[model samples]
Target: MLILGQSPTDAPVGTFGLVNLLAFLCIVPLTVLFAPVGASLAAKLDANRLKKVFAVVLLITGVRMLAQLLL
Candidate 1:
């Protein structure tokens, strides 16, 4: 991630960390805003197929979160 003009990994503690944390926090509203776009794409495709794809996506997300916690 870029902050001001510096890379995140090169930034000092609390600087990039807070920025990343806040960015993650914005996912809620961002998802809401993009929901329509996603729905449109899903419609253009097949709704049933998209639902299955999203189910797998959610499953992978859950597994990744679980692996993170376990690790």
Candidate 2:
């Protein structure tokens, strides 16, 4: 939607601003380096344990967001 000028907000569509581009460039190297390590770790982990950990993380994040919204 952002690229097609269909976003609800007023930001200009179809253009990458300098700040956005720079932030993406900075993240690219970190992602490239860490993704392979994360993949290897995940591959060695037990699937059921990973699922439980992921569920707990999601639950904690959801509760935090809900608390922030309520407060």
Number of the predicted model whose lDDT against the real structure is largest:
1
Off by over 4 Å in 1: 1-25
| List of clashing residue pairs for candidate 2 | none
Candidate 1 residue 43 C-alpha distance from true site, Å = 1.4
Q: For candidate 1, write residues 11-70 as lDDT tens digits.
A: 544555335545556877999999999879887878788888999999999999999999
lDDT of 2 by residue, 1-71 (tens): 33344334554443353234456678899999999998987898899988987899999999999999999
For all predictions, the C-alpha RMSD in Å is 8.3, 4.4
lDDT value for model 1: 0.76
Worst ten in a row by lDDT for model 1 = 12-21
Question: TM-score per candidate, in order?
Answer: 0.50, 0.58
lDDT of each: 0.76, 0.74
**Model 1 error, position 39 (Å):** 1.9
Q: For candidate 1, what is the TM-score?
A: 0.50
